[model samples]
Target: MKYVILIHSNPDPWGHPTSRYTAEGRALSEEQHEQGDRAFDALLEEISASGELVTGEALADPASSTVHTWTPEGHLATDGPYAETKEQLAGFFLIDCASRQRAEELAAQFAGPGSVVELRPAMWSGGDDQ
Candidate 1:
């Protein structure tokens, strides 16, 4: 089974590895932050060695995003994200794992203190659904 772990966090003061130093992340102590970093790195190493990690990437700040919509007249383009919310899609990890339970377990560890992690089964585009 293939699963995608979507990472959501506040876009302000953009930071990597699940926004450990951003908005809500500020509530945690430096030691806690370091622990989270170490844990994340270990998880990545474990998954990669097990051949479960397919790919992962961190997105740029939401301010750099562009929204495009189709209007009756033509196309409308605007700067910034499509949604006006505190949390936005920050990054994602695509993993090909054994089962849903295993994927969920991995997602639990991937989730940071101040970030929201969403795990969903990935669908194939070519009419071959799993």
Candidate 2:
């Protein structure tokens, strides 16, 4: 099965890899931040070696995002994210795992104090016609 791990976080003073240096990131102790980084690195290495990691990437700031919506007149373009929530999608990891439980286990590693992690099965993965 293929799953996508969606990572969401507050975009104000956004920082990468669990918001290590931002004000929100500062909520954690320095030791906790370092530990998170090490854990993330270990997870990446493990998944890559197991051939479960298909691809992963971090997104640009929400301020650089553009939203497009279809309308009767034409396509409408907006300046920011599609949602008005405090947390916005910050990154994602696509993985080919053995089962939903296994995917969930991996997804848990991405969650932090304030970050939100979502795991969803991919209906259409790469090289699939149906």
| Regions of candidate 2 where Cα sits further than 4 Å from its true position | 21-24, 125-130
TM-score of model number 2? 0.88
Clashing pairs in 1: none
Colliding pairs, model 2: none
Residue 16 displacement (Å), model 1: 1.8
Model 2 lDDT-worst window of ten: 121-130
What's model 1's lDDT at 71?
95
TM-score of each: 0.89, 0.88
Off by over 4 Å in 1: 126-130
By TM-score, how accurate is candidate 1? 0.89
Tens-digit lDDT string for candidate 1 (47-112) = 999999999999988888999999999999999887788888999999999889999999998777
Model 2 gets an lDDT of: 0.84
Model 2 C-alpha lDDT per residue in residues 83-116, reported as the tens digit of each score: 7987888999999999888999999988876688
Local distance difference test values of all predictions, in order: 0.85, 0.84
